[model samples]
Target: MNAELHTLTGAYALHALSDDEREEFERHLGDCEACTQEVRELTATAARLGLAVSVTPPPEMKAAALRRISTVRQEPPVAPAPARPVAARFRGRRMARFALAACMAVTAGSAGVAVWQHQSADDAQQQARAAQQQSEQLAGVLAAPDAKATTGQLAGGASGTLVVAHSKNQAVFVASSMPKPPSGKVYQLWFNDAGTMRSAGLMDPSQTTEAVLLSGPVDKASGMGITVEPSGGSPAPTSAPLALMNFATA
Candidate 1:
């Protein structure tokens, strides 16, 4: 594989490459298994990151946008030369109109970008807060006196451990060498309450091995199960369990 071409996987996944470069990379993908796998993973990651969680603009955002727009200086209209031919004067007028339209477009785009940046900042702050909360919950679960862990070797050379703390009503799944789900699919966790199964949470496709704090309380669940489900997960298990661990037997 061409080292330079291999490095374009990110750009190619985002469709940011030039036409010539895209064509060349497509050709390379046909013969390079590593590049093909990378492109698939990169494309999935980009799609996940591109999902927009709408955030309300701040109170002053509108005023700020207006202030930015007001800073744009418009060009004065040019007068056509009287001595020019009729066709030349007409063309000059059309050009002037086009230029004015372009300037207005640029001004609008600038304001839009400012608002977008503000919204993006808000989104990042919210994500950071959510992450901090999850970290604290994970720590609590880990510190529980009744916490118990079960480890098992899964198929495909993968292994995992399930840690549960009844006192905290929380459980965490730790995995190693877990295989990536198929395109448009994700690994989902389930809490087995008696004979019924309830959703725990969806795993991040970008991570194969990591500690995942299950979504809901697990005090009543007898065990935990993992299955391959469509992105965002399904209401019920759509396939056989990839792995299962009994909490009592841990």
Candidate 2:
């Protein structure tokens, strides 16, 4: 039973086996780690094939393929030697067919995985470029000659400065000293736009001193404030701000 089950490994991995054959193979898999590993790798490869983009083949592609096949010389089958047993020859042929089918399936699946990986790499590169451009824009705002800076202190002994570039409508928050928040809590920054409060960003409490880019247009904001919130942060201040700094109007 074990020897026969071993022969079904390729079929089992490709999910081509009958229910009974699959059940028997699974039972054998428990005692065979090599077959288990092969099946896992094959299954993952097959999953990658599902993620591949599908495209309609050109109308002429089938005709072109037939034309190429027609021109190829066909190999004549060689007669088996009289001394070779008929059953052994037939078994050899069956095993060869199974191996060929498994190889073709694996090759197609690998190609699909390669295409998916390439697309993922391209998406990551595009995201990195976008982040680099945003950083450069923020750096320009900080370098502006008209940028003004002011300091503010928090009740929890945390202090930071608000450096605003009025012309650019941007600001950078540089923490001179900030204590780490208790577990499950984080410090969040907000901009007071007139009477409405808008989220600027979250501050990293792990760092003693760090500069954070306050995203969004700052021209309309009259002041900035910070408050303790849950780790992921909140849309609105959940508690009273630890500190607040008002910007001087020119």
Candidate 3:
């Protein structure tokens, strides 16, 4: 078995071989069990890869490739001469195909990276917009003519202040030196709606000192409370309140 022809399994699997080379390889495949097995495996892998590659390479990468191609000097025309040996021609074409495959792999990697970068940028933008909206709502509540505040102390020297604006029907909860919740738990805020407690919002686990705009209307609630609930929070308080503040007295 020719080692050179054995190597052609890759080119054949990729359909990179010329018609004559393909015919020769196919004829060779009849007697070569190893190459037959290799070709079968390579062909399956190529089919799988063809279906997987859908991301379009960035435009800048295409432009750069075109620029590189433009810079390559074309070989000058030569007087008619004897043709090179078929083996030598195959070897040269094989090397060129290998180079092309390497380039394609790099381009594919770049496409993946570009997709990740775009996703990161989109995530950052969404976070920024949310922050801006929260800030505006906080400002509206804090500056309301009827704005009032009620403060309460927690067990671990932590404190929370609830600011309510009856005119705006909005409320904001500010925490300072807040301790981390127990493992598998989170801090949840609630409004004392008449006698029933209604969920306001949950505090971010990552922040120790931060302000949150409570969810839903605050006009009916006469007080606010904080409690430790399971992760993702419960619809109702699962335990006693860590701290409570009376909005009616404030």
Candidate 4:
């Protein structure tokens, strides 16, 4: 894409581009990752700007403006005049109105940009907080005095370990040497509380050695199992478990 086309990024992000312009920019976006990321950031910013409160015009404002316009005489067509500087053409009220309009346009655009920046900052802060919370949870689990770890062999030569914090009703699982599931299928973890089985979470197929934070109540669970299920996972195990580990928790 041409350098000149890059200038339209802001307008494109704001959805101000014409149809043809937008189509061309979209094609350019596929090849240009930088531009694609910029557009995404600007679009998010625009969304934040849209949430701002707006002032309503007075009820009679439109009628009064139309009446004033009706009273003004239309100018007659004349031969083309020599080009003059924009500042040199307007005088008195016309000049004031033009300046005021220009100022308002600039202010509005700046305000929108400002709102986008503020929202971006807020999102970063929220992500940071979430990361900190996750770290703290993991630390607490590792530090538990009664936590026990056990390893067992799974089907297809896979091996897995389970670390449980019985008193805290929490557990983490780490799997290795697991075969990839068939297309449209994923491995899911399950916890057996008494005789009832409940889903924990799905395993990451891409990682040979992966750790997962198990869900459901661990204190009441007598055992844990793993089974292959459809991609989104199943409410109940669809097939026989490939691995099962019984826990004797206090």
- Tell me each candidate's TM-score: 0.52, 0.47, 0.51, 0.48
Which candidate number would show the highest TM-score if scored against the true structure?
1
The digit string of per-residue lDDT tens for model 2 on 158-198 reads 56667777888888776644778888899899998876779
lDDT of 4 by residue, 1-250 (tens): 3544444555665555568666665655545544544444343333323223223458899999999998999999766458943323322224444343334334333212221222343454444344334434544454466666677888879777677777677877766566888888999999977766799999765444455668666767877998889999999999998878876444
Each prediction's whole-model lDDT (CA): 0.65, 0.62, 0.67, 0.60
TM-score quality measure for candidate 1: 0.52
Tens-place lDDT per residue, model 3, 1-250, is 5556756766765767889998787767656655554444344334324323423457799789889998999999766437966666577566666555444434322111111122343444444345435655766676666777776787799877777888889888777667889888899999998778999989877556556779888867888888999999999999999888878444
Candidate 3 segments exceeding 4 Å error: 1-119, 248-250
Steric overlap count per candidate: 0, 0, 0, 0
Which runs of model 4 end up more than 4 angstroms from their true locations? Answer: 1-132, 248-250
Candidate number of the best lDDT: 3
> What is the lDDT, from 0 to 100, of the residue 147 in candidate 3?
74
By TM-score, the better pick of 1 and 2 is 1
Candidate 1 residue-wise lDDT, 1-250, digit = tens: 3455545555655565668666776666655545454444444333222222113358999999899898988899888667865334334334444344334323222111111122343444454345436655765665566777777998789887777888888987767667788999999999999978899999877566555779989868988999999999999999999988888543
TM-score of 4: 0.48
Clashing pairs in 3: none
